[model samples]
Target chain A: MVTAREEILERLERARPPAAARPAAMPEPSMPIDPMATLRDRLQDAGGSLQFATRSGWTEQIQWPVEATTLRHVYSSLNAMPGRGVGLSSKTNHDLADLDVCVLAAEFVVIENAAAWQRPGCLRERAAALLATHLIVVANATEIVATMHQAYARIAPSDASFGWFLCGPSKTADIEQSLVLGAHGPRTMSLILLSD
Target chain B: MGHRERAREFVADVDRTRWHDQALWFVRSKRDQAADLVPDWEALRDQASAIKRSALTELPELWREFEEHATAAGTVVHWARDAHEHNEIVAGLLRDRSVRHVVKSKSMLTEECGLNSYLEAEGIEVIDTDLGERIVQLRGEPPSHIVMPAIHLQRAEIGELFAKEMGSAPDLDDPTELTDVARRDLRDRFLKAEAGLTGINFAIAETGGFVVVTNEGNADLGTALPGLHIASVGLEKIIPQQKDLAPFLRLLARSATGQAITTYTSHFRGPRPRSTQELHVVIVDNGRSQLLGRPAFREALGCIRCGACLNTCPVYRRSGGHSYSATIPGPIGSVLETSRDPATHAELPHACSLCGSCTDVCPVRIPLHHQLLAWRGELALSGHHPAWRRFSLNLVAWLFVRPTMYRLLGRFARGIGRRLPPTLREDLLPAWTRQRHLPTIPKSSFRELYRERQRQPKRPRPQAQPRPRHERNG
Candidate 1:
């Protein structure tokens, strides 16, 4: 088990951005990923408050905060923001498990795709955290590996973990279509665009 | 609880036949079509799974938020950690409302927790309004399948049962005739029902509504015509929105039965606003909260109570649903039962072929066979297996520890297999192989052949492949 963990760490290291090119100034990437943002905009909008891990903000002083300031900020923005004239978020496969409707201040937020770390091993667990709503994907600008299989091939480790995002403001419409927010889990989720 | 023992009897009773097996397989096929229709079916499953997992991780805050928002929506959200508390709370609510006769649609949770008996004992007459549920209610038997409760019964048996119980003609097996009587009987009950109870399919968090999908349309009538609509649902039924239902509707009905969609998908946001009826939503935990924290059983929540697993399960197909001896039965039933007590359900995990058809058929995609395997580990840890079985398994493992002893025993088994009495080999095998034939053993063991081949190599030649199970002679 220890060896497995070690191997996972080694593979994740290869996927990480080069340490030698660390930015001189980094800020949290907490800005909302314009729900209406097209794929191209999402690809370009991968900086600022989104860089929660390296941020030196007031909220980042905490010890080992896995899901930090940026996520909370984005969650709040998504919560306070009203829905557009559009019907709803069209990119999800919502079923009985997730009610697409969400109460703005819901305690339970459903992150359709969860990744605390970009690695597969902890992504499922990390995205499950209450306030951890961001779904970060490190992808190149070009469509080299659009699918999961191809993504693994480019950076595939014999034991490397892989995961993507399905951010959702978890809700359920189970009770006679009476949309109840936070039936069992988080009521909000905000997707974080990393190297999209 | 009225049919609890009868349910066990029915299971054992039907274990003698394969009627239910074929019916369930048909249901499995329906589910396959439902799943196959959605392009993002796998992604949807993964999202549902991840949502449930995320919910489990943040239960405390989420529950609190649910409480806050639901309360704000004018819903009385009460928490019951167990089945008893859940039932008692519902009973007390009915008692408070002075409800004498309550109409209930099909709810597996109510069965799982046995809420009807508790209500009846409290002097409340509970009527199951759904056609299949009403039939089982009239016969005083438990539902055999999650979707088609009376799937095990042939139309003839149903006709007889209804006649014997409801005083219809004994010879009537026409589905149209039988369905008309049930509909009429339930309609009368629905009109007089003071409290309407239902099992929630998906609870929308954005709106304070709960959705119940049914083919009979009874859930709608029960809740709509009644003064009170009391919905009981496990916490995991929460989905994100109404528009998000396209994929689920495609998957759920097909998975549950094989319909492109159920006859009716009713969404009730709250009690009839401005109407005399009151809406009460009871969120039943009943070990679910505990299960929420558990990783292995967490996926069990994603189940839509579709018994596709039972149809494709060789063990469930042969042994039947009754052997499960739970409110829910079949592959999903056994897996969820483990969340309750490993020692009590020791036989469940063993009663499977682990063929993985259940997972394949599951709309939300729970790793059912893995859960069964995990249950075995739990059963072993709790020291629950029978002595002989454990002894034989251990003894074999110990023999395999010694290379030469294992080979000697293997040869001895081969020798005895070749010379055993024909009748003994045919009729005296274990129950697992009662309908299946034993595989023929070769004169020489594979290891012996491999070792010999190493000493004396021969030219390679292609041979015919082994026949699959369907083609094999049973």
Candidate 2:
């Protein structure tokens, strides 16, 4: 009896479509003169916000007025953000439901969609950013890329296991098309752009 | 039942029907706003369609490349010829680990394969984590819409269901309140489940990995605890290169919803480092290869499951997704259901007014209306049309063949139209006349008018210059 794979291959061979030429590479549209300024606007559109801070002062600036809840900084790189916050582990996955705020460092940020890239090491407990009611990321202004293409190109060196392009806080419009934040994830995502 | 009967039933409640129509129209408007933001929107769609075309043409090669790379990345790859085999492979994976509980996030393929029922029959409990999916699962109904699984339901209906299932407040009708209830209820299931399954949005052959895009972040949460992550992907989801994801990613969120991007676009290259985690990809070909064999219907594979076609479709917006009575619904579903069983889905092709709005909004530019037309022709050729339709069509064809007869018939129609009352004319073609007016017949036929003009010499009236304002007043 022919295997499913061979059968499928045979059918595909029989059903070959007519030859079609590959589309020419699309030209990237020109970016705004101030990509960071545009990025802030787009971030707000996507239910995320941003604040500018000095590189050294970003840690000090990471403060939330919401009281009585857990705050986590999951990444191991202390010098990256220079913060001392509660850490997240796999064991915390069960109890992170009440997490109020989290501040971690993004590998790189995409300006077009305001997506923050998180590589594997810092994202060890995947739920750290997601479970929190509010998430804050501090990244150097130099790490911002103009588009997703640029962001994808920069991921080759990270050896990421579960890399992500987190655009905004978790949201859902499934209920009568009403936009609601904090749907099984962070209600707010605030990025601190640390200028050198 | 035919689309007309089902759609009529769906629209029986006029107020709810209007609400449904406005709701989907809102989504379509949002899509327009998001799509306009990209200057290269059409270019991205073109590239995406072209990439999908090549991917389908060279699927056998890409599948092998994906498998090779995925296996080398410490991921196990499995192939299933059909739904039964696909369910068995997943069941086998779970049995090997003695896993009794599984958490799943919005994989429509599993719904297609009847995986949940199959797993439950084998004594494993499965929980759907997506807020919309969980709602319909508790109600024991299939997803009414592909993207918004419970779109057919109202918030009050959901509130009632949640009250019973999740033990929430009985009178809870607010969307956010109900959503919070679901989140609190499913949080423990995500952490305790032994295995997690998700659907693939795009499977990159170059990296031997896949991407799962979700706004709720349920997939990430579900797979965080369980060391085993099983991604059930259709063969058509495979793209030739990793870079090909750029155009698809840009179009997906904009077309699906108005969002700039989904909250999370998670790229799982391999299983995480510890906890004996493993990434297993089951690439299923059930009926897809057969679809690939038909050139006329081949473009359907280019669909990205955005449901933009559904939102813009007048028929779908009015009739609702459930009226199509297929796993996937709306214009795309109408054509796709025909492939599964043309006789059963024969009425679906007739559901459209053929306005072609679906094609206009399609991210991959699948000629959905044209495909539906083809399905109609094929169905007619197969003699699946009702006897009255066949007879009427034959009568029209016969009348058009004879010039004199056709002219006489036209004259008779004009005479009848002049003599008949408006209400009688509406009864003649109830379907067309129900919501619109019939056109008035002209006093004379075009042929007669042309003959009369030929009998007279052509005369040009004197050109009149425009009068000044004072002269016009005088």
Top lDDT hit: 2
What is the C-alpha local distance difference test score of candidate 2? 0.82
> What is the TM-score (0 to 1) of candidate 2?
0.91
lDDT of 1 at B356: 85
Off by over 4 Å in 1: A1-196, B1-16, B240-246, B421-423, B426-432, B458-474
Give DockQ per model, in order. Answer: 0.01, 0.60
| Per-residue lDDT of model 2, residues B241-295, tens digit only | 7777889988999999887789999998877755478889998988888788888
lDDT of 2 at A169: 81
lDDT of 1 by residue, B1-474 (tens): 212233344445444455555655655675676456445667656555555444444434444455555566556766555688779889998999899999998899899889989999999999987666777777788886676676656778778877887788999876756765555465566657788889988765545555676644466556655567788877667654333343454456556655444434555554433445566777766666556556666668777766667777766665556556767778888888867776676677776767887777676678999898888777777778778668876897799789989889889989999888656786663343345677776899988889998898677888979889888766
Cα deviation in Å at residue B435, candidate 2?
5.4
Instruction: Give the residue spans of candidate 2 off by over 4 A.
Output: A62-92, B411-474
- The most accurate candidate by DockQ is 2
